[model samples]
Each structure stands twice: as C-alpha cells, then as structure tokens.
Target: MKILLTGISGQVGWELQRSLMSLGNVIYMGRNQLDLSQPDTITTTIRDIKPDLIVNPAAYTAVDKAESEIDLAMAINGVAPGIIAEEAKRLNAAIIHYSTDYVFDGNQNTPYRESDLTNPQNVYGKTKLVGEEAISSIGVNHIIFRTSWVYGLRGKNFLLTMQKLAREREEIKVVDDQIGSPTWSRMIAEITAQIVAKFQQNPSDFFSNKGGIYNLSPSGKTSWYGFAKAIFNDDFSNNERKLQRLIPITTQEYPTPASRPAFSLLDNQKLSDTFGLKIPEWDQALKLVLDS
Candidate 1:
C-alpha cells in the first residue's frame, strides 16, 4: 500500500518514516514540500498522491506563541487538516491525525479518558480541538491519536531543552505542580505502525467496527521537575555540567502565554483494549531515547 506521510521534519514524523517503511511504500513530505498553511496545496497533494493512507504528524505546535499568532496557528492546526480530511474522503483513503492533551482544561484530578469532555483553556488547544471537530465532520475513515508531553532524540522538545540547559547552566527551574506522561516519539510511531498493520490484515474489522480517537501515551506520569531530574541524573553523572540545583516551582511562577493543563495524564485502557497493544513506562521509554 502507498502511504502519504506529512511533517517529515518533526520528531514523530522522522521516526514514523522508519516504522511505516516496513508496511509499504511511504511518500514523505515536509513543510517545504507540502505546507499546511496552504489549503489548496494540501488538497492538491492528497489528490495527486492518491495514497491508501495519510499519516499527518504535523501541526502548529508553538503552544505559547499561538496566543500571539492565532491566525497562523488556526490555519495550520485547524483549517489545513480539515482540507486534508475532505480530500482523503474523496480519495476513499484513511487519515491518521495526532492531537494533544491540552484539549482538556486540566480540572480533572484523574486520568483523562477518550469520552471525557474537552474544555481547552488556551488558544493552541482550542485550535486543535477545532481540527478534531473538522475531521469528525468530514465523515471519513480516520483515527485521531491524542498524546501528551512528546519528547525525542531530535527536534525541539522538553528533553533536549533540559539537556542543553544542564550543559550550559548551573541551575534550572521546572514546574512541579503540572503533571503528565512523557511520550517518546519513537513509541508513537511504533504504535501507529502496529495499528496500520492491524487494519491492513483486517480492514473490515477496523472500519466496520472500530475507527475513532484514542490516547497514545506512555503508561506513567511525572511533573516537569521530575522529568528533568531524571534526565540530568541519567545523562550527566560525573561531569561538571551535571545539574547542581533543580529548583521546583509552580506553573504560575514560570508563566507562559498559554495555560497548560495542571494534570494532563491520559488513560490508555481504551487504546490497549481496542488494539491489543501495551505501552512501556515513561522512564523506560526515556531511557531508550537517551540511549539512541
């Protein structure tokens, strides 16, 4: 089967290129080749490629910047995916889109389920929710994966940021009040490939019975401070650059333009039960990333 993969430059997209390759032919495109900001370009690309599946791992991910650049954010995060979904419908192809945990307002103390109501507190989350609604309205075969706290070896993510800071600075401050699972992009790609293989083996079983949103994250949770401490302990043990002071602070102390969910952990029971898949612990996944 021929698959069209977008956001080839992103961390998840980069890993997905390798995982999806075993299944069939994958035509990868980055923003330069297929910019999400251009609706006509997305429609034309999908029409021209005529892929059996379209894996969209791209979005306007500037969470804090979205507050200032609402139009650009909405165009890429909200409007573009809608056009892709519409085109996929016309081509009778399946679409796989990635969302975020920010869709929730962070009020719930327990892990979030797929059925939980979404009340985004920030502009970035609102636009992503809009994208989800658009895809749902298209009435096509699509699977939306909501993930949280994604990190990887490459790309600008929390893990890399912490690593760089540990090397350059003597001390660092991280938010301890907010908690979520740290997902490895590699795991996301692997799970996505597994889902695609399942569908390929039994297309009717998936299409006629199951095809909807599912939370794709690691099994455990941690705060930003904990995550950073773990990284520092693992990456630099005896070096002079080892983190000397990791000051834990609240979200309000280190404020950004976007308001993040206080507790963004997602329950994976639905995804595991539906796909017969098991995710590793967040720390194990982090180790794998660091090792790689």
Candidate 2:
C-alpha cells in the first residue's frame, strides 16, 4: 500500500512516519511540499502521489494565537482538509484526519462521546469543527479522530513546556480548572497504524461499513496542574522540581485570548468497541513520554 502523509514536522506526523512504514511505502510531506493553504497545490500533490491512503495530521494548533489569526487558522485547519477530502474523493483514496476536543463547549459533566453536539467557544475550535464538517459533507471514505491534549517529545507541546519550566523555574503555576487526557502523539500514531493495518486486511469492510468520527484519548483525565505535577514526579527521582510546590491556579487567573474548555475529556468506549483497541491510561502513556 502506498500512503501519503502530511505534516511530517508535527508531533503526531513525526511518529506516524515510523508507525506507517511497517504497513507499506510511506511518502511524507511537510507544508512546504504540499501546502494545504493552496487548493491547487494540494490537488497537484495528490495527483502526483496517487496514494491509497492519505493521513492528514497537519493543523494550525496555536489555540491562543488563533484569535488574532482567524484567516490563517481557517485556511490551514478548516479549508485545507476540505480540499484534501475533495481530492481524495476524486482519487478514491481513504482519508484519515485528526481533530481536537475543542470542537465542543465544556459544559457537560461527563466525558464527550462521538455524537455530542459541537459548540466551539473559540476561533480555533470553530475552525477545526469546520474541517470536520467539510470531510463529513464530502461523503468520502474517511475516519476523523478527535483527540485531546496531545503532546510529544519533539513538538512545542505541554510536556516539553513543563520539562523546560521545571528545569529553570523554582515554582510553576498551572490551571487546575481545565481537565482533559494528556494523549501522547506516539500513541495516536500507533492507533492510526493499527486502524490502517485493519483496513489493509479488509478494505471493503473497513471503508464501506465503518468510517466516522471517533474520540481518541487516554482512559483518564487530569487538570493542567495535576498533569504538570505528574510529569515532574515521574521524571525527577530526587524531586528537585518539588511537585508539591507546583501551584494550582484557576483558568481565570491565567487569562488567554481563547476561552479553554473547562473540561474536554473524551469518552473512548466507542473507539475501543469499533476498533477492538484499548486506550492506555494517561499515566501509563505519560511514563513512556518521560522515558523518551
């Protein structure tokens, strides 16, 4: 199988390169090579590659900065996926796209399901929702995985930020109100590869019958404060960072341009039942991330 992957530089994309290589020949492309902002470029790239599967992990992921850069965000996150879906439809290639938990407003008390109503609070969420809508409307063979709190060793993510802060600062304050699972990008890539392998084995069953949005996250949830504390505790045996000193603050105190979901935990039962794959607990994945 020939697979075309976008966003080679991203956390998930970088990991996907390894996971996807086992399945078949993998062609990785960065923004410079396949530039999602340009519909013509996306079309040309797809035509040239003619891949059997297209994995799109590229996105405009600056949650706070997206408020001021709506046009840029929408183009890359919203419109680009739509164009890719259209091209995929033409080529009869299956698409795998990554979405975010920000698609829903954080009003619900329980974990969000695949069928939950999406009412994004910020521009970033709205744009991601638009991308999901575009894929759904195109009526093609696609699977949209809506994940939360993604972090990896290579990218500018929460884990890296916490690691940096813990090394330099005496004390760090993290938001305690916002709650979600800290999904490792490597896990996401592994799950994507598993799904692809399944498809390769039974293409007709995988594409014709089962293809829709599924919430892909770890089993448990944690606040930003708890997550940071866990990171410090797991990494430093001497406790130099002093996890106890890591202060917990409310979201109100740490103000940003975008309003974060108070709780963005996603229910993974649907994904597990559909794919026959169990998501590891956030703690289990956190250890692997720290080890790396």
TM-score of each: 0.97, 0.96
**How well is each residue in 1-292 modelled by candidate 1, as lDDT tens digits?**
8999999999999999999998989999999999999988998888888998999999999999999999999999899889999998898888999999999999999999999999999999999999999998989899999999999989999998988888888788999999999999999999999999998998765765778899999998999999997887644554757567888999989999899999999998899998888789999998877677
lDDT of each residue in 205-254, candidate 2, tens digit only: 68777799999999998999889888877445455553335788999899
> Each candidate: what lDDT?
0.91, 0.92
Cα deviation of 57 in candidate 1 (Å)?
Answer: 0.4
- For model 2, the local distance difference test gives 0.92
Residue 169 displacement (Å), model 1: 0.8
TM-score (C-alpha) between model 2 and the true structure: 0.96
Model 2 ranges with Cα > 4 A deviation: 234-244
In TM-score terms, candidate 1 sits at 0.97
In model 2, where is the ten-residue run with the lowest total lDDT? 235-244
